[model samples]
Every structure is written in C-alpha cells, then in structure tokens.
Target: MRRSVAVRLSALLATGALAAATGMALSTSTASAATGGVTGYATQNGGTTGGAGGQTVRATTGTAIHQALCGRASSSTPIIIQVEGTINHGNTAKVSGSSCNTAAGVIELKQISNVTIVGVGNGAVFDQLGIHIRESRNIIIQNVTVRNVKKSGSPTSNGGDAIGMESGVRNVWVDHATLEASGGESEGYDGLFDMKDNTQYVTLSYSILRNSGRGGLIGSSESDTSNGYVTFHHNLYQNIDSRTPLLRGGVSHIYNNHYKNLNESGINSRAGARAKVDNNYFEDSKDVLGTFYTDAAGYWQVSGNVFDNVTWSSRSGDNNPAGPNPTSNTSVSVPYAYTLDAANCVPSVVSQTAGANKGLKVSDGSCTPQSPDPTDPGPTDPGPTDPDPTDPPTGTNLSLGAGADGSSKASGTSYGNVIDGSTSTYWSPSGSTGSVSVKWGSATKVSKINIRQASGSGTVNSYRVVNQDTGAVLASGSGTGVISFSATSLKKITFEITGASGTPRIAEFETYAS
Candidate 1:
C-alpha cells in the first residue's frame, strides 16, 4: 500500500490465483484490459479464488452460463465463464445438474463454487434479469451490467435484486459491475445487492449501484443477524433512498467509496451491526450515516471521511444520525490490510474506475488510476504492498472442544480455560506477552479465528496467528477480534500475543473452516 504504482489483473493470471483462458493467451492486450484480482475482505476466508485452476468457457447468453455450471464435474468444480453481449430471461432457462440448480428467467448460481462470470469482448449486460446465488462459495462477478430488474411485476427475477445471495453463502466477490433500476419500489425494483440467511465473507467493490429504492441489505430483518464480515469499497452509490446498505448483524468494513444523491438515509446500520468506515466521500447526501427506522441501534468507527454538502436531520427516536459531524460509536477490528485513497479525490477516482467499462482502471494505492498493462507485468509489477487481511468466516466455533496449550500460564490460570466456553474462565501469560494455542487430534482445515480477551484484562495490541505445522504465519496484525488467512489444514495453530499493555487473559481462541 505504500507504493505509488498500480497492480493489474494481468499479474494475477500469472499467480494461478485466477485462471486464464486456455485457447486465448491472457497476456495479450485483448484479455488484459480489465482490472483483476480481489481486494478487501474477499481476500480472506481461504481467499475467493474464483474459477482458478478450472476450465475456461465463453458464454454469450445466460443459458450458456447454466450449461457451464451443469457440465462441471461437481458442485465445487472450478470454472470461469466469460460473458459478452446481452443475457436476459428469454435466454436463461432451468438446467439442473449435480453441479448446479438453475431456473428460468434468472441467472442462477446455486449449489456451485469456484466460478467467475466476467464480461469480455464488447461487454456484457443483463437485461431485466438478476443473478441469484445461494448455497455456494468462492464466486466472483465482474465487468458486467444489470439493469431494470423487477421483483413484483409482470416479470420478476431474483426477487428483483440485481445480485442476491442467501442461504448460507460465503466467499463471494462482486466487482466492477453496474446494477441500476429505472425507479424505486413503486416501479417494482429492489436492492442492487442483497445478502441474508447467514451469508458472510463477501465483498462488493469497484462497482456502481444507483437509481433504486434500496441499495442493499446485510440481513432480511432485525432477528436475521446471521450474515456479516462483508466489505464495501471503491463503489459509487447514487440516487438511492436508503439501505446502502442496511446492516443487521455481524461486522463490516466500508471505505474509499463515493456516495452521491442519497434521497433519504444511507448506511442504515442497525440491530447491533458494527462497521469500520474509513476515508469515504459523501456528497449531496442526507442522513448519510446512522441507525434509522428502529431503535435496535447499529455502531460505526468513522475515520478520515469527507462530507460535502451533506444534510443531517435532527436526531429523534429512530433517526440517530452520525452527522452534522460524524464520529465513532464502536470499534471494528478486521483481519485484512488496505490502503485508502484521500477522501477528497474519491469522486474522481471512482468515476473513472467504478463501473463495467472504462478499461478496468483501478487505484494505484496512491490516488492514481492505473491502466492495465496488456503486456503482462511480472512480480516486479506493483501489487498490494501488504495484501489486505480478511475475516474469520461465520460457522461453528472450532475451539469449544479443541486441545489447548500455550508458551506459559500464570498460577491459578489453566491452559484449558481459554476454550472452556465461558468468558469467566481465562488463560493468562505469566507476564505481559506470551502465546496460547489450539490443537486438534487430526488435521483441521481452517481459514479464520477469533481472539476474545476476558473482561478487565490487558488489551492485545499486536499478535500473529501461526500455522504450527509449516511454521508459517497465517496472519499478523494489531488488535484482537477476527483474524483470517488462507485455508490451511493443520493439527495445531498458535496465537502469539506480541504486544500488550498488561498481562493478557485470552477467553477464547476460536477457529472456522469457512
């Protein structure tokens, strides 16, 4: 992130993190014109390597996409579908298979994983059709446009959402796409990006969501706090009423986005949702940040943000706004690292890079929009100086019954205390800093972990999550909460508390496979 140069997708093709077309050389200028690679929290949870190391197929219609999904060897098969031209209900139809669960009138990515649908050639557009994803993971959507999809009229698709994910979805990244409606809910339109039913580890970046009633929502209702660990950055939200988006539960990171013409409320985080908002630009918007509609209350950690011509209504009942002047009400610690562009330059940077077209230009990490190097730059090419960290995905806590040990334990503090499932019991280092670990009898595949410090204990300033099997550090950063890394199968994992203000008491060291 300290570097001023840009990172390109062409470079990612070389890393095998993203697969390339077999017939067509991705190094060529024709294939290298788009911004590539995933950023933000999508870089976590085993990393959303969509379609990597899989077959590459081209599709000009939605039906072909279904064909690609059904033709796969299994539901988890990795495959990339390159799309161009237009895809609509007329061309998208039901095609069921072991690898897919398809339906007519919508692009359904259900019960599938490791798939990427990217626009190619002249460009790709979905006409009045939505892309619905469920029971899936490790999917990416990029460089396309979806317009005028309706949920409740003569024609409805994906419940009127341009891109909707639910039913325990995970590790999905939607980037550089355009999602827009002609009007608001009266026009039968709905959210551009909606996630619910325990959806987690998702990112929406470098896209545009505009001209609709609701931009998006993390949960369906207050009690549906089953979804979270989502990230929104470098996108443009314009001419929308509210819910850009509405967060219900869990945590999120919102940064470096441009918000314009918000009709009513924006970022209506409620139901105890927590967001880390950083370096964003809000222009001509109303009640931009707040807990609205209900008193359940959402929280945010706001820093380095810019507000221009933004209006704030008087706080009353459900209308709790973050401005006249916004400030932090909570703290959210993520597992990833990201560089933010200056808030003042966000509008220009987003305008040139946030949509389907515009040559897939992206931030150089220094407020510069860098172009794709069709020539295929190598390792020397500017990349993420420090790849952003991700979140420990949502699932069953892995530490409840796992084995526990540490470098040392203080008197009256047993090593097993950390995994006892009760915050009242805890493990403390003999001194200010030490290490604790969770081990299993057999190899366990893990992509995320949580460190909960017992109440009234010294705060963990910095730490490293290490894979004891390979002596590799999975993640290293400051703070304690969610810590994630690439999925690694190992019998033992260590949490090294490197820096602390006082003797630390770790109440839990939880792990997850997702």
Candidate 2:
C-alpha cells in the first residue's frame, strides 16, 4: 500500500501553513541571581523570579509591550505581559539601561531582566515586525506568531529576524511559537530565530518554522565561539530551504524534532560546533546532518535518528555527510535531566504540541514549584490532545502504472518509477528539465496529483499539467506542493517540468479521483 500520505501531509501542512522550572531555597535575591547555581534548563534562568514575584500585565499594542518592559519596578523583578492583539512595533526609542540601540520600529526587550511575553485569546501576532533581545536575562516567549520581518526596506527590525537575541543574554525559553517568512535574504527576509554574541542557557521547545529560507543560527561567525549550551526539542521544520539551524560553535542538544523538505541543507554543524542529535525525524530532505560549503568542520554524536527518503551529497574535502550510518567523534554530556520520545512519535507529538494555541504541555525537568498564572483573563489552556491521523480526502490512485504505460523525455530513468508506491526508488531525468506522461488503458477521472521528491533537493520551480489528448492545460503552478483541481476524464496526462534547480528526481507522482 502507498505510505499513508494524507495523514502525514495534512499534519505537515496544518503546522507548516500556520516550559519551566524549579529549584532551591536560597534568599529571594540570591535565589533569582543568574549565578544562583540553578540547575534545570529553565529554573535559575530568565524572568522567573525577577520582579514582584508574579504580576500579570496585559498589552495589545507594541507601545504597551515596550512600556511594560521599561516600566518594570526593577530589572530583577519578574512580570508577565499577556499580549492579545496584533503588535505592530511603532516604538524605536533607546531605553538607557536596557541597551536598546535601534530606533523605534521593533519591540526591543533590552537591558530588562525577568519578563515573559505570551499570547492569549486568539493569540498574539507580530506582523511585519521583530523582537530584539539584547543584554537581557530570564525571558520566556510563548504562544505567539511572528512573520514577514524585513531587513532592507524601511521599518525593518533585528536585521530581518522574527526573534533575535545577542550579548549577555541568558536563561531564555522560547516555547510554542510560530516564525515564518515568504523568502530568503534576496527577498529581504532572514532567520526565523537567531542567537549570537555570548548568549547561553536557552531552550527552543515545541515551535514551528515554515516557508523560511533560513531556519536559525547559533554563534554568528567562526571566531565567535563563546555562545553554546542550547537545547532544541519537539519542533517542526517544514519547507525551509536550509539552515534548519546553522550552528557555528556551540554545544547544542537537538532531539525529537521533525524536519521535512529541507531542499538545500539541514543541521549545519560547523566552525567547531558540537551537536548531540538523537531521535529526530528527517523526511524527504537532502544532506540533513553535515558540514557543507565551509572548510571549518563541526562534530556530532548522533543516535536513533530516522532519515526517510533522504539523499546525501558526495564527500568532498569540505562537504562531510553525516549518515547512511553516522559516527560519533565526541561525546556530549547534557547538564540537565530530560526524557526522549522515539523518533517515530516526533511527527505526531510535534504536530500536536509544537505551535501556539495548543496549550503548553512541557516537561518539568527540575520539578520545581509552579508560578502563579502568567497571563491575565487567563485563557483556557488545554493539555496535549492527539489529532486524527487520517489521510485527507483521497481516492484510489488511478495512475499507479499497474496496467498503465508511461514515457518521459529522459530515457535512463524508468517512467514507471513515478508510480511505484515505494519512496526508496525514484526517476532522475538526465537534465534539469523534462516532461513525463502516463496513458491509462481507458479514460480515467483525475482530480489531484501528489508529487513526492526522493532527494527533495531538485527544485520544480514551475510546472504545468496538461491533458495530452484534448490539448488542454489542467493546472500550472510555481513551487511544489499537492496540486488539486476539478475532476476531469482523460486518456493521457502529461506533467511538464517548466523550471527547476537541478536534475529532476521524482519519487512518486500519484493521481487520484476525487
């Protein structure tokens, strides 16, 4: 049987289109200090015990969010800012102690310590804006969506990052949020979440990153290797071309995450970076774990990873592929205690728990006491609930090539590979562009076409679907995804590859009747 495409694709699109605590009894001030010997990933970190113990404030505008951060009674006091509406940053004034350098255009959380910015109600969205954190500590950002942050034009924020942090930052937990962009640096967009300049002790848990060219990075440059000790778990990365985290020089723990359609590269560990990769799922991607294009090499300790329908490049001097079987050069010892979900459970676990509005179902690594409700008007927070894992509306695959015949412009690859139902095999055209057509024994009704890429690297930038017998075009598009149209009876259908990045490698081209 065809691998259950509908269930996986639905979960992927639904997520692609759209923590805490603990420890000890020292004095209040001594207990909250960054050097308080706080052990867990989040307990002795940002904003937990900063201000007047647990004050929840609400903000709807960007200005209000700034004021809440600036208006804190003291830098060490902890406070929560519940954001309800869209926060289009309009403020650009530099707060003196907070070290905000940029002019008023982005939400600047500078210099302030101990703050939590969370979304409530319909959830908060930062549209065409960015959040900059510099010289800050003890921060938590949860349940928010950030999109379309630009760099070149006017009103740009954090050099186009949806969330950017640097310089003296510590103890930050970014959970259950969505960060996205339409294109890459050429389109005035940059990374989704970035950390650099001595930042440390951070955890990015249960988040979604989609349609972004750059996912994120740690340690901005080769010489800047001080930033390290970060954790990434249970996140969903979809349709992102590259940098499913380009780690420069850090000790990063990457576990239980799901990566799909990473066209160019993924998990670039270079510049002496050391990553402990365990129990992660990589599907339909290319060169998922390796050091590419750069001479500076990074190392990894990989275990229990599932690379399904993935392809790897040749091992040149600089291009080092991590696996058909990955080996560990160095061992990493994680400071805190945590649990690991199996790689197979990552897609479902991450899809249900990863982004905002799904309730905060995080593991308590330290099992510390809970703080008072962080946000006001206290929106109902639901526990993690599994979604129905069924394929979307689909019919029998009529183009399975069982009794059918097909032909392609390229001859080396068998045209029947596209209908073979197996993802492990594929048909690669001799050149970058070509066409493939299938003829049924009789007229068949077709409504949808699912194109699965075996390598997931060859780009079908534009394409056209035509009914060969009637000489009529059925569908045309730019970019790759499931293509659906009104059901039409046809004896022959041709899929013409109009544009692409490399030699086309199609794993499966399944046609269905509605």
Candidate 3:
C-alpha cells in the first residue's frame, strides 16, 4: 500500500530549449549517498519507479537489488547489501561471475538479522565469501578484508576451515579485518574466522591472521557441556601448521599476542574447553604434537608466558597395560610448564646435544656433565630396595652413562681430584687432561643443570661439582656457570674455565630430571 515516483522536476525551469532536458534531469534524479549506508537513485527515460516511499529500490546492477531482496528479508527486517569495488577472479558480484562456483556462500545470510555488509574503498574479495552468515542473529562483520576464499574442489575430511559456522550460527563478531591465504585444500585449510553454531558471545579482536590454512584461530562444539565463548585478544598468529592445531576449544581466552612459526600445538584444548593460556609469546614454534584434552584432549591450565624456541611433544594413549604408567608417561612432556605466583617454574635448558630425548636432569646447578655419576646408593635417602649409586636404582633410565665405561675426574686435592678421561673419550687436548677431570658414562637421573654460552662458539668460566666416589667439593660457581644440585654419585664430571672472563672459547653441558 506504499507507492510514489517523485519524478516531478519542475522542467529544469525551461529558459533555453528546456536547458538540455533539465541538465539530463539534474543528472539522473539526485539521490546519491553510498559508502555502505547505501542510497543511489537515478532513473530517466523509463521513469516510472516505486517500491515507493521508503525509496531503497534503485539499481545500477548489484544483480537487480540481488533479486529484489531475495526471500523478502526478515530477522528484524535486515537486507542491506552495500559493496563498492572488487570481488575478483575477474570481477563480478551478487550471483554470476560464477555465483561462487554455482553458489554455496557468496552471501548466504539465510535467517538474517541486524545484518550489515559494509565495504567501501578497500573491501571485497569474495572469491567465495566476504559474507556467509547463515541462520543469522545480530551479526556484524566490520571493516572487511577477506581475500581468496578458494574451495570448489578438493575436499576430504578437515578440508580447510575458512568460515564454517556449520552447526547453528549464533552471536558472532569478526572485527577489524584481514584474513589472508583463505585455506581450501586441507589441513583445515585456513582460519575459519568467527564460526558459530551452538553459539555464545564470541569475539575475535583486532584481526590479521595470515597464512590462514592450518590455523590462526578456530573453535568447535560437539558438546562436553557445550557452552562456547571464545576471545582471542589483540590478534596475530603467524605461520601455523600440521594444517593448524591451535585453538581447538574449551571456553577460551588467549591473551596479548604474537606467535610465529607454529607448526603445531600452540594452544589446542578440546571437549572440556577451559583454555586460558595467558600473556603470550610463543616464538619459533614446532612440536606441540597433540593432547590438551576436553572432548578428551588433556586437562588444561598453562599461564604467564614467554616460550622462546618452544617445542613440546606428547600424544600417546592406549592401554595394553601390564607394566608402567606414571600418568600415561608419554616420556614426560616438555618445552615448558608453570606455577609462578605460588611457586614452581622451571625452564632454562637449551644446551643442545642429547638427542634421543628422555628429558629431566640437572642433579645439581649451573651444569657441566657431558656424562658422569654412578657410585652406588649415593644421592641419599636409600630405602626402597637400595641401588641408587647415581642411578640404576629405579626404572625408566633412558641410558647415557648407563651404557658404562670409566676413567673420570674432578678435584681440589685428594692426591689430585681426578676424572682420568678415556672411556667415553673425545674432549681432546688429551681428553683435555686434568686440573680436575670429570667424565663418567652411565649414571642416570641428574635433575637439572645449565652452563650456557656454547652455541657454535663457547663461554663459561669456573664450574664445580665433585664426588667421584668422594673427592667431595659438591658445589662451586663463578661467572655465568649457573648452579643447582643433589643427585650425587660421581666418578667424573668436570669443567673449570673458558671464554667470557674475556670471551673466546666454549662451554655448555646440560641435563635435567629428578
């Protein structure tokens, strides 16, 4: 019941031959107001327009008002489609420029609401979807930047998660945009932006998720008490992999931010979702193999952070159980873990060369023990079956010195504090002969030691730890020879000085676990 075609231009005040048809009817009926808020009416020759009074019905060609607002638009009367420039592949929009490979989501806002598709200037890269909001609610997609959303081919399980809110589309917000490398082939493809379906208050703040194929941020809800509320603050998650295992889900909050080179597992809590990984700085990544459960991933809680050179591997479960189980022992987990404020934060190893990896050793501090310790019932508290002469007193040994052979040393003076050298060899100057020679090759469990400054070159001055069956001394420090001990049973493990009192040589001997 509303119709009006105000083409009443008073004839351009006809003074000179009708002033050129009223200056082309004042340049096509003056309506002009487009930069998202949309308003552009211009009709001349066929002059009889009307949807009428609330004049929005104008067309230059965005597919004829997208088929006159398909399905008559509801969800509180939301039907605003404003697109200025660039929907590449070769340019085309609103169905046909390939209607998104014959259509799946070019603009599938099915059950729409306060649907706002604003983009003026730098916007539009719907190689697939610049907007897909299905079963929509108060949906708001701000400052848009979504390029190459490729997929119309190759898809097996997990074929890239660019924007799949597959389940039920709920309160979603994707702000300040830039979603690059729009994943499509597999490995979960790329960052599926802000997905929802079993939804809740979801917010992805200030975004710029690059190389989006295997992960920048992702969430899911299969139901382990499915109450999903994800918040990834001040964003930027770079080069993720294994197709991307970050942000698996469990009521999330991943703060501050900057994660580069993440091949896998930066943060992937699942099923029982309560993932709160704070502060944030996960550098040069790789090796978070899998497991931080919910739908049964791994009970989570990892705080305050700074993981430089991060690498942690643990993912084994299956009970054929007849022998050992310290809590499923996937060879004990590492790269880092914490407690802080309440006390218990250890991580400062990185001395290299101990590659078969069983982890945990530093028998005492400011490290220096390429391999030494094994005297018999030595590290005290002997009770349970008594064999502890450095190690071999228990199970789980990962063999180092446990591969046995002798000629070790350490000293101050007991005929001359010894570590004769030989048995494991190769430190040469003659096995670097004694002022205090310490080298033994088969005693396990030396709970944590770190004497840095030897990566390519070297540096470590004054170091001490002796017992080699009692030439005693036990602990000494000088300069950067950092220290800590308590796993005694030595035959030889010695280092006295090098570089950095002047800096030219090398020194780095590390071990951990108790």
Ranking 1 against 3 by TM-score, winner: 1
Cα shift from native, residue 444, model 3 (Å) = 87
lDDT of 2 by residue, 154-205 (tens): 5687799999999989888787889989888888899998999998888788
Candidate 1, residue 86: how far the Cα is off, in Å: 0.6
lDDT of 3 at 322: 12
Instruction: Write down the lDDT of every candidate, Cα atoms only.
Output: 0.78, 0.67, 0.35
Q: Residue-wise lDDT of candidate 1 within 1-514, one digit each (tens)?
A: 2111122221012213112221121221111111355777787888787775556555667777887788788988777676778998777778778888999999999888888887754579999999999999988898799999998995899898999999989999898899999988899999999999999999898899999999999999999998999999999999999999999989999999999999999998899999999999999999999999999999999999999999999999988998998989888999987888999999999998898854556775678876443232211222212112243347898888899998998899988987887888899999887899999999998877777778888966446566676444455434566655556788989888766788898887788887
Clashes of 3: 64
- The predictions' CA RMSDs to the true structure, in order, are 20.0, 19.3, 31.8
Candidate order, TM-score descending: 1, 2, 3
**Which ranges in model 1 have alpha carbons more than 4 Å from their true place?**
1-35, 372-514
How many clashing pairs per prediction, in order? 4, 13, 64
Better of 2 and 3 by lDDT: 2
Q: How high is each candidate's TM-score?
A: 0.68, 0.62, 0.23
Give per-residue lDDT, candidate 2, residue 1. Answer: 11
Model 2, residue 507: what's the lDDT? 72
Worst 10 residues of 1 by lDDT: 3-12
